[model samples]
Target: MVAERTSRYNFTPGPVPFVVSGGEGVFLHTTDGRKVLDGAGGAIVANIGYGRPEIAEAAKQALTGMGYVAPLWPTENRLRLIERILDRWVPAAAGEAGLTRCFLVSGGSESVDTAMRVARQYQVAKGRTERWRVAGRATSYHGATIATLSVANHDRRRQPFGPMLADHPKIDPISTEAAIKDLEAANPETLAAVILEPIVGSSGAALISESDYWSTVRQFCTDHDILLIADEVMTAYGRTGTRMGFEHFGPAPDVLVGGKGLGGGYAAIGAVLAKEFVAEALAEVGDSIMFFTFSGLEVSVAIADRVLQILEDEDLVNRAAKMGAVLRARLEEEFADHPHVGDIRGLGLMQGLELVKDREAGTTFGGALTPAIIGEAFKRDCWIYPAGSARVPDGMMFGPAFIISESEIDQLVSITRESIDAAVAGLQS
Candidate 1:
């Protein structure tokens, strides 16, 4: 059994959570000697899985050998990582659009903030100084940072900071017509950029946009001269079975931000990839983008490079696609007739299960139901992500490691079924 401990901190406002002893592949070993399946891949971050010795070694080497360098200065690991991203990782559509410049940052939030800044700077350089507002989708999350929160529309996350957030226009994620109306209402001339997640994460797990909607939005942005920023922090680096989620759609975004799977949980790192025109405008303006203090750290970059190598060598991206099919099939087979299962949708390994009170009417369960499901799943030795919003009232998300075996997938499904049943039973009781 695990020893209990107390903490002065109250991040969760309860007793300290279980201590994680270690992890191997897709399972997390707790101090209590329970091997819990990392169903959500620790918030969908561990793409390459746990206990990767090669990545650890690369980090060690960089830390011991090169130590530190100013973030603005170039280093061997940083340069190699940039080359890898440009030559191997970035989507073909982005490359064709001349998105060749990369700006490294500490994590997802910083990457998004940097992308926003780049968009504004590009507009300024083009003498469109009045263009400063950014528009985002209503059921989306960019990051926890103030600027990202300002542009994002997640109700719960933004509620506390409403006064602090900038009143950016928000549009419906699925409706291109609504976006057009909102953009026109907000005035195109005052808008610097339009930011969106190719596949919505956190706020509404893996909420994918239709291809036609994406095509329409891309054209509208082009016609209006608004820079398009793709927040691929959760969907980039092969999480969506593609090199980048935007590839599944048309016309690459003017600026792309990536994180989460970029380092595969090996290190805290993120990057902003910009088209040549955007970078050129910034360059011509003679104002370089400022760097994060820990941006391009040798060790972090080295670890990220090694993680990328592992992804390519293992072909984990393709694996994600194949396994995602298997997972979707299994889920449909098990839950298609389930009374509480309303919708199961997503692409690649990123999937969401929307629970409902009335399937025929498409009504959602109460908000508390999702947390109860999360608790039930945790009790059953699986850790799935809970996602909810005004639209997606009760849902759970899953994006396990790409390396998870078929047997593990079976186990995951079994546990999920059991957990859902248990949670529903409890609600009835």
Candidate 2:
């Protein structure tokens, strides 16, 4: 183990810090030679396993061929990647929604911020300048940027910056009626768009909504001329057994934002996909769209393109679906009756265990039990993501690489069960 040290400039140090030397497949190796299972895939980002030589080679080739290019200029790599995302990777459901244009960015936060700006621009182009407010789910998370944080409802992330954020209306994630009520109260005329996670992540792990809820929300947005934005940063690219998370529901979003698995942690990349009508509206009002300096950089685009190719060649999307079932089934069988486990929910590779003080009474631990649980899991040579807030209280998230085997899944579950018991015992002690 490494000793804790503080630096004058270090701002966001982790609770338990360790030095990692390298990773291969689904395990991370520490500098001191300890192997830990990457249960959460580093914040649920690595859909594909680590140490992929092909991806490295692709990036190298791109760097050698075209060192750098400005965002304004188009490159072959960027065009090819856009083509793959539009013609090959996009789900049929998203295609039906008329998503035909792509705007590349650096990461989830930038993608979300850009999407919000695009929504505002679209409304303005349609002569609805009064539509400026955007509604987000009360328990959902979009990203860390100012614009994204303003619209998102993550309590802890928004607590310190409350005064600086816009007072956007927050709707319930699970109830369409609550959303309708809030929208009505906010006055639909003032609302430009509504952003959703389809399957909520971070604040709540893989929290899913009913199909009817999505359908109703979609209808309401369409009827009122409010654009619907789907934040698929954590749920897209085979994480939920679908290319896009919104495909799980009946209706589709007018704009979709994706990150994380898009580059499989091999490159920093994200994209905002707009429907044909939405893009056309923006086109009508020329010079409304802006670009980031690093948007659609050649090397990153090449790496992302190769990642998509690997996913298709190995049929890893289907593997995620099959292995996800195995993982969820094993977790349920092991933890469903555990004393401290309140609920086990999620889709595909993204799963979460809600912890509670009294499972029968549906009571939460009410404090900071998540950090303790995460610490215990680390002690057991496993890395699991901890999720909690004022809304959710406590949860443990899991999103291993799609290549995880049956035996590895069993091992992960066993460690989690033991860690949960150990954590709860520590709390009592």
Candidate 3:
């Protein structure tokens, strides 16, 4: 069995949990002959589903051609991907040019690094040496890099690296007035950029601020000459129903960072999109952003191109909106009255549920509640994304593939209900 074959490479020589041999649509085929429903779409990625032959063909075609062009040179796939994103995916609300500059990288961390550095560079190019800090939301998360972790405020992820990270100022997560106060306290002149997720994901379980908060923050950043950046790493490319998360409200951001769903789980690709002015500011000073060695790999670019086209051709973005409503209704039906379920939040296909000790008291059951609930789901051949950290410590996210059906959504929610109950019961005992 392929499951047994994995033991040969375990180093320690032991049987492990079931290994995924393949995936199709909404399910992962395990080596143990189990069809595990991928409720979280592999860490809330996977937009169009898996085992796409078209993506493989696009990648193979690119690989057969000139495979390793230096990122500085614009290859065919690289050019095509940029055109597609700017013309189709970048939100129209961003104006005529609509985030005119696109920078590609290998993955999310690199993308965040590129964005943060670009923001800093833009400031330096404009002779704003005093503008060195980037203000982030109190509960927001950017990525894995030390620089990103420093700008972000996930308490658990930042705990170990506290000594190394520069202390970036943090603003109130949901209140415009409090956020303004935080910004004033941070000394606005020191801020180069303000980075945040339009809809908080992993660290806050799809949390969204009051609608006015985004617009107010945008104006605040503008008034202070601070570049406002929307970190769309998890909410871009139709994951949140709209083409982008910021579309829910607010004027266009100066910079937008994207990842995960950009390649639809087909390739390791990420992007940073900047408004024309931001690029012009750096270019006027003859400064150029650094590129990673593997930035915009032709194979990855080709695969991402196909994924975007697939989303457009099949109208999957709209499907996400309709299916998101279905998902929310299903979750409400199953968990609204459950004692341990505290709150439901999210948009499009990226919904989340918060777990608490008692809904009436709003008391938390701290410690390993998320992992325990996840373990229960896994036992029944389902996989849900574990989410929440810091202030909101126990929550889970349901970000299934855009192509997921009503039946699949029902099954996934049912499994969630069973899993939550089983875990809660075990905790009670």
Candidate 4:
């Protein structure tokens, strides 16, 4: 029955996984009575954990008070969420002339698409209508939308949409000199923006470029008048300990994209924020952004505002930083010597565990290792997010809720180790 129902709605063809009945705190309850720890926070969402009664109350009030409103208009919840992000969350954390404007959308893809459009629009508003290209790193995942897919270079995801995607110039992900050369070759006058992730998530398994690289890129973007956009969908709002992932390094991007954590898995909401000058240029032209009808749903904004308030009142951001240290220590202590585990790297709670055929030989088993390992982990009552691209072959992301306890961390690590071993044994046999 569970298999039939799951297969009916989901697009994926599969032997159905167990039905998730409910979730509380850091654990998910199965319909069959199996309780599993949430290791990946439901695709790296769930900052405040699960089953919070406060979220329910907030949702009820929002729907009962004033239901639906158009995107352009401002209601109490919309105003509150905008004020919260502008005044408390992003203002200071964003670079010198901080972000002064934001647009709310449904999810990561929409948020990314909005940023891409704004970049193009910014150029058009400034009379640089010829600049339409948005450069991005060779291996990155902004979102699933067509425009975002065109800007990013995740091979597998873009395979089917090759002909439809715009051929934006690409740059090296790590090398500063190569990246600079690539930028110059892209022809500054024709490029409008450059999109990047603070730490490469799915495409590179939380890859962190040196601080110098980010600083250099910032200067290069500034020199060329190309806006730098940071896609923080998977690393913002307490996931990276800091408010924004870029805070770990130097200056902030001209445009910042965020989602998932904003609503803490309670609502589907995303935001694309821009520096003051970018918005002013568009406003000066008396131009505006096109809004998606469900841009800022009354219920969603209410839930998101309530969620951010909870994150603040409970000090979960600081807790994420503190607990992230403990999670890192546990991962290091456990997987440092494991052969299948090649590397462990990340900031705050968003850590990536790399997989290899053999760590000593620096060999990889391509992308096959990830699914095998993930399958094993699921059997052990843990679900971790599989992370990789065609370029970055195999790995998994471990992003639990900020409220996760030390003992829960222990179980997660232990289960992961055992799952890796089991998968390896199965492969050998």
Instruction: Provide the global lDDT of candidate 3 against the true structure.
Output: 0.89
Q: CA lDDT, every prediction?
A: 0.87, 0.87, 0.89, 0.89
Error of 4 at 377 (Å): 1.0
Model 3 earns a TM-score of 0.96
Q: What is the C-alpha RMSD of each candidate to the true structure, in Å?
A: 1.5, 1.4, 2.2, 1.3
- Give all TM-scores, in the order shown: 0.97, 0.97, 0.96, 0.97
Model 4, which residues run further than 4 Å from truth?
Answer: 91-96
The CA lDDT at 95 in model 3 is 55
lDDT for each residue of candidate 2 in 200-319, tens digit (9 for 90 to 100): 888876777765878888899999999999999998888988777777786779989999999999999999998999989988878456889899888889999999999999999889
Candidate 3: tens digits of C-alpha lDDT, residues 95-170: 5645899999988888888988988999899898988899999998898889999999888888899899998899
- Quick one: RMSD of model 3? 2.2
Misplaced by over 4 Å in model 3 are 1-16
The backbone clash count of each candidate, in order, is: 0, 0, 0, 0
Full ranking by lDDT: 3, 4, 2, 1
Stretches of candidate 2 exceeding 4 Å from the true structure: 4-9
